[model samples]
Target chain A: MLRLADVSKRYGPGHWVLDRVDMQIPPAQSVAVLGTNGSGKSTLLRILAGVTRPTRGRVSGAPPVIGYVPDRFPAFDAMGSLAYLVHIGRMRGLRTAEARRRGQQLLERLQLVGGIRTPIRALSKGNAQKVALSQAIMVLPQLLILDEPWSGLDANAHDVLAEILDEVVRVGGSVVFTDHRESISGAYSTLAYRIEEGRVLAVERVAPRPRGVPMAHVVLADPGAECPPPSRIDWREVAGVAGVRSIDEAIHVQVHPAACDGLLMTALRGGWSVAEVRRDREAGRLGGGDSWAH
Target chain B: MGALIRYNLAAVVHGQRYVAPLLFFGIVLTVFTVNDSGPLANIYVVSASTLLVSMCWLTVTILNHEDPVRRSIQSVTAGGSSRVLVAEVVLALLIGVGLTVVGLIFPILSGSHHWDGSGLAAGVLALATCLFTGIAIGVLCSRLVVPRTGYSLLLALVVVIAVPLTPGLPPVNPALRLMSGNRPAGELLYPLSGYLVVSIVVAAGCIALTRYISVRRE
Candidate 1:
């Protein structure tokens, strides 16, 4: 976990950029920082990344392997995309061969292999952003911090990055990012914070879902007389069951469609027979009313 | 720190900024060889001064290329700003020494006059001191001033004019005094030692200043 206490940043004698901000980033959580221009969102991220120091506060518990992507990638004009990624990977403590291999893999995943040998200065804006992200994930950092990571990415690349973030969280890594696009924040963020007048305030806590993937609602037969009660079962231990609730003789399990099979297997192993499985399409849809249908 | 040094060395080499300094040294050596009017010592002095300017120019350019903002990021990523600054300073010194060695070789290759081994050693030491002093001052100025290019160019110009004019400052004027043949061996040792001590102090002071400013701003 990363914690910030009474963190404040001021430049010279000017007004504070961040005022008494306190935040905790726990493992396996995705946090979204939101604010208007000059509202200290980037400053907050920088402090978290240790790229900047707060004037009168303390920060602790920063993980050793942190992947940070600033708003703009620094100009490594003389270095090729692959070389730059390799350099960053090496800096983050990867062995030379491993760094090279990972650099290749990240660029390929971002669809930037065609320009691997091209100088960073020559890459297009969106492609350059991909390079920036490639460096951040080269080491699969335990704590990944990004500032406007989705700003210049194309549609396909956007989905690719979302999947990567999801994988990072699934493996118990933490992600903290800031983005202006509501669609992005709404889709992947588990917690959101708003920066208002240099103060950080918890705005909303979201229960993240797999985007565009429907949820599965399963009904399981009541446990036999010798078996434990359904409520006594720890559904969280099931591979894909996100949540479990028992209603009368039936048990309702919420899970991603991909995890439906795993959920059924776990239920059967626990002495509960599976009765039916159906897609909870309405529960999976975002927003509400007619607006969501579109 | 090793990675930073390797990255910087590769960047400097691949960027081809070293070319301009080498070319400048070559031009100065060729001009002296063609003219052949002045004393051999005079030729060496002129060539050495040109090398000093080139070394300072290269240091300033490489350091300025990474703006303070970028440096801050590098500092945090690399664990601290001191490591990054040390790597940069070491690269600058290595480049300066390499250029000085090449400059010293030019006079020997020309065979215009018999060169004493001690005199050659003293010349290289003096040139290195001058280069170190220039880099320290240049880094300090680059951090304090905006439009780094303008300030760096201005600093280079000042060093070129001031080093030859003020012969009392041991480090800055050693090359001039040594080339003139007026100073005895005993006299030269005192100034050379002073130059070494002053160089260390200046480099340390500048690095400390850079760190202080960087931390405060961050």
Candidate 2:
């Protein structure tokens, strides 16, 4: 957990860039700092990353290993992407071999393998951005901070970053980034903070969308030899059944609400005893209303 | 700090910024060796001055290559500004010492002049001290300016003004006098000691100032 108390930043005789902003970042979640240009989004991130010192107040619980991607990556004209990542990994305390290994993995994961030998300054902007992100993730940081992490990424790279952030949160790490594009932020973030006039105003937390397809729990008695093999059966022919997973004698069917009845009828007609029929609540509500009502 | 130093060394080599200075030093040595009509002391003086300027330029180049914003961020993530500054200063000194060896050895290798063991040692000492002084001034100037061209020009102007005005400063003046072969033989030990003390004080002071500026700027 990271907490800030009355943190403010101002230049010499200038208006406050950050005005006594207060914030908290809990573990296992992704938080976004949202605001317009020059609205202190980057300033807040810099402060959190410990790059910029605040004029007043205190910050605590900041992790020793922090991964930060600035809005603009510095032009390391002389170094190649892989070399730069390895250099950063070493600086973050990884051994030479480990740093190189992780650097290779991150470059491959981010689709930057082709540019591994290319000087950073010569790479395309999007690929350069991938290099920037790779350096940040070289070590599994306890707290990750990114400023407009998605701005220069292509579609595939964008999705890859989202998946990486999900993995970070899943492993109990925290991520704090700023993005003006609501579609991207809304899709990935668990909580958000809006900066207006240099203050952070809390926005309502949006619960995560349920993962995977809505699976219908179907329990059936052992099928006799007359029953067709589950793999050979075309479960899609049953109305609303999207897919089927058979575990021993029980078949877990993924179905749309309209096809739930059809799925049960097909099973009963096949002489399979129906032990129970109910929507998988853990799969999240499907299209709202009483998802389990049959 | 070790990693930072390694990274800086790699950056300097890869960027090839050291090429120009090394080439210039080589050219200076060739010119002095070819033009042997002048006194051996005069050759030493001119060559040492060129080496001093080259070392300063090398310092400026290293600092200029470092992006201040990126460095600040790296400092925060890596540890602190002092560690980064120490790495930079160590890198500059390492480069300075390496170049000093080359500069001092060229005259001997070319057989331009012959000197006894103590005389050769004194020459090496004088050159090394001057190079460090140059590094200190270069670092301070690099922090004060933004563009590389600006700092290079600024450093040149400073050397032009400072070299001639060395008479007013004691230890530095002695070191310069020794390089120029104007000091008495008996005064070598005293002046060399003074130069050593002054070099340490200046380098330390400049490093502290750079750290303070870096922190405050961030």
- TM-score for each of the candidates: 0.78, 0.79
lDDT of 2 by residue, A134-181 (tens): 888888788889999977786557656866787788889999999875
User: In model 2, what lDDT does residue A254 have?
Assistant: 51
Candidate 1 lDDT by residue in tens digits, B1-218: 77788777777776776687668877876766553544445556766677667766677666766655556555656767677777887888887777777777776676465556656656666666767776766566554343456765776678656765786765567546766675544456556667767777876787788667766666
For each of the candidates, the C-alpha root-mean-square deviation to the true structure, in angstroms, is 11.2, 10.7
Using DockQ as the measure, which candidate wins?
2
- Candidate 1 interface RMSD (Å): 2.1
What TM-score does structure 2 among the candidates reach? Answer: 0.79
Q: Given the true complex, what DockQ would model 2 score?
A: 0.38
The TM-score of candidate 1 is 0.78
The fraction of reference interface contacts (C-alpha pairs within 8 A across chains A and B) present in each candidate is 0.35, 0.50
Error of 2 at A51 (Å): 1.3
Chain B, per-candidate TM-score: 0.82, 0.84
